[model samples]
Target: MAETKGLGYELIWKFDMPTTINHIMIMEDIQYGELIRKYKVEGKVNGEWRILTEGESVEHKRIQKFDKVEVRGIR
Candidate 1:
């Protein structure tokens, strides 16, 4: 996996090959206090986009799990 840091509001990752994923973890820098309130996770499965999961009130970190699915990309 690779990560690029920037001041953007979205992140998109495309794998070199299809991969099976079940969970994702997100973290926030809260030195100034919690700022994120809601978020969503989408996966590209079978060449289509699907909503995998969503949640609210993310203080420092969040871990979201869903049914295993083979995906080519995630955002």
Candidate 2:
């Protein structure tokens, strides 16, 4: 993945069926110092993409929580 100037790198995950998601956790290898400084989580709902969680200036571990939502795709 190539990192952009401001956008950074983007990764996506898709599922065949809608899955219930309540929490999301990201663990980065600390050996490389800080890998991700900012991140966002979005989900596809009712044919539209929505932001579920986002943050700025993260370090080794990041955990986000929200109301349980059923999603088929996430980025």
Best by TM-score: 1
Query: Taking the tens digit of each residue's C-alpha lDDT, what string does model 2 give over 1-75?
Result: 122133338767777778889988887888968878778889888778999999975677778899999988788
Scored against the true structure, residue 54 in model 1 reaches a CA lDDT of: 90
Alpha-carbon TM-score of each model against the true structure: 0.86, 0.82
Mind giving the per-residue lDDT tens digits that candidate 1 earns over 1-75?
A: 444333388788878889999999999999999888888888989899999999987788888889999988888
Model 2 lDDT, residue 51, Cα? 97
Candidate 2 TM-score, C-alpha based = 0.82
lDDT of 1: 0.85
Please identify model 2 stretches exceeding 4 Å from their true place: 1-8
Clash counts per candidate, in order, are 0, 0
Candidate 1 steric clashes: 0
